[model samples]
Every structure is written in C-alpha cells, then in structure tokens.
Target: MAATLFPDNPDFIKRPPFETDELRRCLTNYLDTPFEFDPSGARPLVGNYRWGVYAFFDYDDEPIYVGQTNEQLRTRIRRHLTNQRTDAVAMSVLDPFEVHDIEVWPLPQFQDVDPKKDRTAAMAARLHLDALERRITAQAITNSQFKAILNEKDPPPGELTVEVPPSTRGCIVSDRVREIRGHPDFRIARRALIMSRLAQVISERQVKGGLRRVMLTQAKRLEWLAARRFEATGGARTVPQEGDQDGEE
Candidate 1:
C-alpha cells in the first residue's frame, strides 16, 4: 500500500532517542539539591564550598570512585562527569556513564582559606579532606560486593582521620536514561568496552601498578555482572535444528 507524505511541522518539538540531555538535567538537579545543615533548616549546603569529598556509585549502588577537592565540589565533579578534565576520566579509570548516584561531604569551614596566602591553614584543611576521603574509601570498599571500587589508586594511608559529617546523596540518572542504560545486557556490554579500552591504554603506555590494579578490579566487576545476569535468566535453553543430523562431522 502507498503511504501519504505529511508536511513537516516546525512547531512540534521532538525528543531524542538517546537520553543524554535528560541525564544531564538529572545530574544538574541532583547537584542543586539542598543539603540539610541543621535541625532548623536555616542553612542549606552550597556548591561553592572549597574543601569537599565526593563518591560515585554505579547503577547497582556499588561505590566506584572516591575523591577530594580543595576546589569547589561542583567544579570537580562536573569536570569528572561532563568533561575529561579529571585524571580519572582521562585514564579511563572512571566512566561517567556508569555513575548513577553521588554522595558529597562539603567542608564549608575552609571555604575562606586561600592556599596562596594562608599556606598553613590551607594545608591543615587539605589534611582533613584527605582523612575524610580515606575514611569514605574504606567504607566504600567494605560495602562493595567485590570488596573493591574502580579507583586506580586508593587515598594515601594516614594517621589522621576525621569523623563522618552530614552528607547529601542523590541519584543522577533520569528515568528515561535508566530505561536504556539500566538494562543488564547493556550495562555488561558497556563495562566490557570500558575494560577493553583501559587495557589498551595500559598496553600502550608505561603505566603504574595502580592502573593495573584498576584493570583487575574491572575484570572482576565484569565477571560478576555477567554471572548475575546469566543466573537471573536461568541460562539459555539449547535447541536442535530439524534439518541438522545428530553426530554429523
């Protein structure tokens, strides 16, 4: 049957098949979420805080990376996810697509401390940030199903440690994005591709042992997801073709 051609409608807006824009909005909304500073709810956390620590979690709610920044958490996290400015992204140690949730600890106390002018105060604040990062990293490792995250290098061990502070956590993936990326098969394929790219990077350069460790962790994660999917599907049933002869060489 012949079909009639319709005139283009310029006034109609169409949504994209891919959810990139939706995901970006979800991330922005998550970052803009107000954190409860106290019982009175008078002070909400802002994104301009200078000293902060953050963590990224995957679709399965597994921690994938942890980092601290003396700069603004908003800037550092946006660079990691929206662009390749962060070393972790450049090295393929962290894939922004895999990040489904974020948790951040903002230390507003050091917002006014400038490293150039007050070196001592800045250094002290950095130590506290580092300590907080290390503690969070430990918790992530303990909570992870594989007992490891994708960070190429763990936060350096230190004698100093800080108490956990009030933090805000939120999902960054939109429902539309989840409809596609949240599928098990899609996730497995994406993880495998990232692992392959990371391996190729390692092979092409004189990389450190920490990078190698990341590769191993990726392998484990891939294997675990694959196995889980297989189990959930109860494996595929084998069938014989009617035209095929049994035991034919």
Candidate 2:
C-alpha cells in the first residue's frame, strides 16, 4: 500500500499556519504580562485593570488610537482587536492589522468602584480615567509627526489633570508576523483600504466632524508612508510620454 500523501488531523480540520498561531500566542502573552508593580504576580495588566486608558501604536511607532474603558481592559481591548466588534473597528476608524504595540495605564485604585453600588466613587473613578485618557491623548498628538492620531473623536476637554501613572507597554505582534506584515507596501495597502471604508461610512451616515478628521489623518499617514517607499525604491526616474517631452499641461 502507498503511503498517504498528507497526514489527516484527528478531527479532520485544517490548521492555521504556525506563524498565525504564533501571532495569536504573542498577543495573549503580551496581555498576560504581570502588572509592572505587582511583585507577587497576582494580576495581569489587562485582566485586572477595571478602569484604564490604552493606546495602540502602529508599525512606525506612531500612536494610532487612544481609548478609556471602565469595562475590564481585557474585555474591551479583545473586542476591538480580536473580535472586531468595537465601533471603531466596525466603522474602519481603526485597523487591527496596523497595530504593532500596545500601551496601557491601569487604574487599580478604581478596581472595586461599582457605578450602581457606589455612585460617588464611580463618578470619581470616571473622572480619573478621563483625565488619564486626556493626558495620553495629548502625549500621542505631541509625539506624532502630523500632530494627530487616528482617533475619530478628540479626548473630552476637562480641567481635571492627572499625572500619568505606571504603564505597561508591549509588542503584540510576533517577529514571524512582523516579517510578513512589516513591509511598507503592505501597510500602505491596508491603510488605504481602511481609509476607503471609513470614507464610505462617512458618506452613508450623518457623521460628526471628528470622523472626517480621522480620515484626513489616515490620508496623511498613507501618503507619508507611500512617499517613503517610493523614494526608497528610487522614485520614478522619468515619465514615459510621447516624444519624451514633459507634459506641463
């Protein structure tokens, strides 16, 4: 009898590539990292943080999104990236594929603050979260070359100010995944697709001005990346036109 050409899985199901599995594992590992100050390792950063602000950074180390959640950080972030259920993901305001690094500032003091049980504490916790988010948002903008991140809406204005707390930052993408997705052309294509979808969303709905701002920022980022790639590849030497004449018109 001839040997089988390919071994069959016990469940008769195809498996994803090793890199794909590795990528997911990397993400989980990053999220599971013990909070920096937790010496006893009692809690993971994302899982234990009941109120927090998180930022997503793209391959170029540019802050692309900022968000605050009273919901468990793990639940909210997983929904955005893995589940693709958040409004930002659904509306294409953010592309999970572009996120390379994640930075989170967890508010552990508010971990037990329950809105229904203790309205005053909950309100104060919310204020702290808002202030932290605003600070992060400002930092993101200041660090950005374009002076803007891809957030569809600006962080809410508040006189309340808070110093940034201890934060945890990690790369969510595995090196294997980076090798496949790190090419500028790949990123440019992905950004263009997301931008197109965002534009479509704006056209279909009576969206706020903030959504349009996000589209503009996306366009700038796309253009900047494309230009870099083009120049790096030795930009078009000459135009192929009839008689080799410059088309001034």
Q: Give the Cα lDDT of each candidate.
A: 0.84, 0.85
| Pairs in steric clash, model 2 | none
Q: Candidate 2, TM-score vs. the true structure?
A: 0.87
Model 2 whole-model lDDT (C-alpha atoms):
0.85
The best candidate by lDDT is 2
TM-score of 1: 0.86
Candidate 2 C-alpha lDDT tens digits along 145-213: 999998888777789999898889999897778988898888888889988999999999999998999
What digit string (tens of lDDT, one per residue) describes model 1 on residues 1-249?
Answer: 112243354334354335656766777787777767644455655456678899999999999999988878878888998867877888788999999999998886777898889999998997898899999999999999889888888787778979998888998888878988999999999999998889989999999998999999999999999988987876554335688778732
Q: Which ten residues in a row have the lowest lDDT in candidate 1?
A: 1-10
TM-score of each: 0.86, 0.87
- At residue 89, candidate 2 shows an lDDT of 92
Per-residue lDDT of 115 in model 1: 85
Candidate 1 residue spans exceeding 4 A from truth: 1-18, 38-42, 236-249
Best by TM-score: 2
